[model samples]
Each structure stands twice: as structure tokens, then as C-alpha cells.
Target: MTIGVLVLIIISACSRVDGEMNRVERASGGSPIQVVTTIGMISDIVQEVGGTEVVVTGLMGPGVDPHLYKASQGDMKRLEDAEVIFYGGLHLEGKMTEILEKMENKKLTVAVSKDIDRAVLRSGKDAGGSQYDPHIWFDVKHWISATETIYDALVQYDPTNAEQYKKNAETYINKLTELDAEVKDRILEIPENDRILVTAHDAFGYFGEAYGMKVMGLQGISTASEYGSKDVSKLRDFLVENKIKAVFVESSIPTKSMEAVIAGAKEKGHSVNIGGELYSDSMGEPGSDADTYIEMVRHNVNTIVDALK
Candidate 1:
């Protein structure tokens, strides 16, 4: 395949997680709670809680890398009409960092992921080689906190539904708790020796921490980072030495690095398989099995368990 086509194939694997799809007219009526989020998963969570009460839109879509995304005319229209804007903060949206800052003063925009404890955030190489890793949704617990923050924002926007929002948040949190348990149980089914997780990017630190598995990615959390030859060689060594059964690719990032890893392992007389595509950066397209936040987590667990067990 041509490089572009290969990239498309990798991204299409993640098409399962692109939750914010082409606009659908939301249920008309009680009150329009316009919410603008950075990606589809957040939009899905807002819809789950806001129900038919909120109208939501997102700036990023399937295969659209958020680190490099630039808001277009359509985004401006969405922002102008929104009652509150919700984004995954901690530098997840790289280019729109400034836009999110400016919106803080004008709109009721909040970085819903801020509720996560700083200790849980992974650091970037700056400010003494430490900056927060912004992919907080990888862990269901952190997202549970984010859901609470979202509930507060929704209540703030439309207090009339405060009771309803709280109830919705509780319901969602319970589901997340169940998801957390399910993922752990599934990962436990993998033999202890095969519990290592290798992927295209380092977006699963929280997932590793939560599930008692080790995670290694060829690139950084953001797809903007190109996988270095050294990293790939190192990962190949790790996979071989540990006898890792499967190395997975992510839905959003290119899987060339993963292919390189698999090839390198084969060269050393160790065999490994590409487990399956994982939903990392975003959720699936609307109406697909992995579209919603809960479904996204469940599907990921099922895929991982099936492959690694």
C-alpha cells in the first residue's frame, strides 16, 4: 500500500471511536444546551448526561489528529452558538490551546479533565522535563471524575435540570465503575507473562496503571511524534525478550511502527501477531457498537482480552 493508504488503514481501524459524527439535528425543544467539545468521546458523554436536552458538536473527527487540528469557519459557527464549551484539557488539543484559552473569558468553556489529580497526569519534557499527559480518558476512573465535572457544567448552564443532570452523572459513573471492573477482569484472563501491552503510541499509561499490565508505545501520546528507529528497535527487543504474543495498533495513529516491530521480532526468530486496532484518541462513529463512551471501553476490553488471552 502507498504510505497515504496505509495511514488511512490505520486511521480507519480507529474509526470505531469517532463518536462525534456528521451533525444530526438533536431533539428539539425543552431548552437547547449547546456544548462544543474537542473530540467525539466528550460529545458522547455530554449527550449521555444531557440526553435530549443538550445539542453537541465537536471540532475533531475520525482520522483527524487533534494535536494538529485547526479550527475552520464551521468551528467558529459552532463556538458562536454554544452555551458552554467542554474540552479535554492538559494540552490534548495542541493547536487550539490558544483558542480554548480565549474562549474561557467569553463562553462557559471548561477543561472537564481538570478534575484529575495532578499525580495521575503523565509529564511531558518541559518545565524541568515535566508536562501533563492529556489523554486522561484512557482510565475509566479519571473519566468518572471528568463526568462529574461535566455534570457540574451542565447544571451550571441549565439549573432547571440540575436534578436530572446529577442523576444522569450518577448513572454514568456506575456504568464506568462496571467498565473498570470488566476491563480488569478481562486483562486478568491474559496469562501473567503475556500481559504486556504494546501499541502505536504511549496513550495507555493510565490503562496500564489501572489494569496491572505494562504498556509501551512506539511514539508519544500525541500522534504528532514520529516513532524513532531507536524506539522501534528497543520495542522489538522488549517484545522478543518478554515473549509478547501480540502487539496492537491504535485507531488514530499510523501503524507502520507496529509493523516494523512485528517484522523485527520475526527476524529474531520470535513470532508475534497484530492483536487488533484499539480506540485510543477518540470513540467510534455514531451508531457503531463502539460509539458511546461505555461501549468504547467495553469493546476495547473485549478486543484486548480476546487477542492477548
Candidate 2:
């Protein structure tokens, strides 16, 4: 080959190598990472810890129930492209877990809820007793531990920002501590006998267990479970016999079922009013008071205390 032709080929190869090096440098630089979370609550936590360092997206939107949610084509694309994916495992996202598990080896996927102690969770709630209650966030104290788990995960993923993540997690936890106190004060206002929280589903079990209240729902711990006629009748009878004053409804699910429960109780000559809608199975919209984990707990406690007290 001519010397000029050989030099031209060498120049072409060098240019290609330089382009590849530039791409690598871009990736290694402190560019904001892409994080995808399964639920809004986890998304909020990620945002708190990662701050502007991350571009986080929540797969489940407002009022979207994750219990029965199936990921769309868009979701899979987002999952594949994300630098990290956070899911609240323990069967919370029932339909999406299997798919996510298969991709565990290929992607940086994490189950944030797995950080909670297994003993603290209540099992045997689902039909076959295999399904555990996945609502650890209902208890603010439990969520404090979840935050620690998240902080640790973030630090591991981005060691350079360890101190920043820790500081952010600490700040959020302090707010949560204040929230726990507020919830206690608010719940104490309810009369002991009137502290019964009758709802559409058994989602509030942990919340009730945390605070001093008797929680009953038409459906089991899972919203996916259908409320049999027996279940409905039994709950209605219990409401009438107990003369429970207020029955609450959830924001994500249809309130028609809960309203029917109220009507059924009233049919038995028991008067029960519909209290304000409770934020259950999902958190509030961004920027709303119920958006943050702390705000959500406080809102629920205040709502319950006001209606039951």
C-alpha cells in the first residue's frame, strides 16, 4: 500500500478510538444518574437522598394501584435504560415482581422493602398464607429503617456521594421522628371505644397495629382479594353491632364499595358516615402535603383521629 493511503487508514482508526474514549469519559463523569422506582413513596425517598444528582422516575403514577399494576411496554424500556431500579418487593407489586426478578442479573434492580425485619411483618394474610403483608411504610418507625436501607444502597451505588446521601437521609429521618410524635398526639384524641377504623380493605392493619385502634375492612390485606358476600355481611353486622360512627374510603380504589358498606350498615338501623378519603396503597401527588412519607402518615393519623374521635 502507498504510504499516503496507510496514513489515511491510521487516521481513521485513531478517530474511531477517540470517539469511543469520549463516550466512556462521558459515562464516567458525574452526570446525573437515571433511577426508576416502582412506587411514588420509594421515588420520594430516592429523590431525597440523591437530590439533584439523580433523575428519578416513578413507574406508578398518582392514584394508580401497584397491587394489580402490570408494567406497560414503556415501563420495560424505562427499566432497561435506567442506571438503577428500585422496587418495593415482598409481593407489593404482585404482577410486576416476576418480570423484574428475571432481569435481576442484567440490571441493577433492588428491593427496598426487603430491608425491613421479616419478624415485624405479618404473614398468612393472603389466601394461602404465602403472601405477606407488604405495607411496612404504614408504620413510620419501620419506614425509618427502610430509609437507612435506601441510604446504604445509594452510597454503594455512588460512593462519592456517600456523605451527601447520609446527610439527606438523616434530615428526612428527623422529619419522620417529628411526624411520629405528631401522629401519636393526634391519635390519642380518639375515644378508646370509638377508635375502631372500618374501611373497604384491610390495608390499614399495620397502621391500626401501630396506633391503638381496631381496624376492620371488607376485604383482606390485599385489595386484589374479592370481598365475598359473607365478608360484606359480616363487616356490616360488626359495624351495626359496634355502632361504629365512621367508615373510611381509600383514594386509589373506588369508594363505591365502601359507600355500599356504609349503606348496608345503615340498613341495619346503624348510622355511619363516610369519613374523608384515606391515602392508602399509594401516596399523594408531588408537592402535596401527602406527597412525602412524613406528610402521608400525618394526614392519615389526623384523618382517622378526627373521624373516630
- Candidate 1 residue lDDT tens string, 284-308: 8767778887888888888888998
Instruction: Give one clash count per candidate, in the order shown.
Output: 7, 0
Off by over 4 Å in 1: 1-30, 126-130
Reference-based lDDT, residue 88, model 2? 79
TM-score of each: 0.87, 0.88
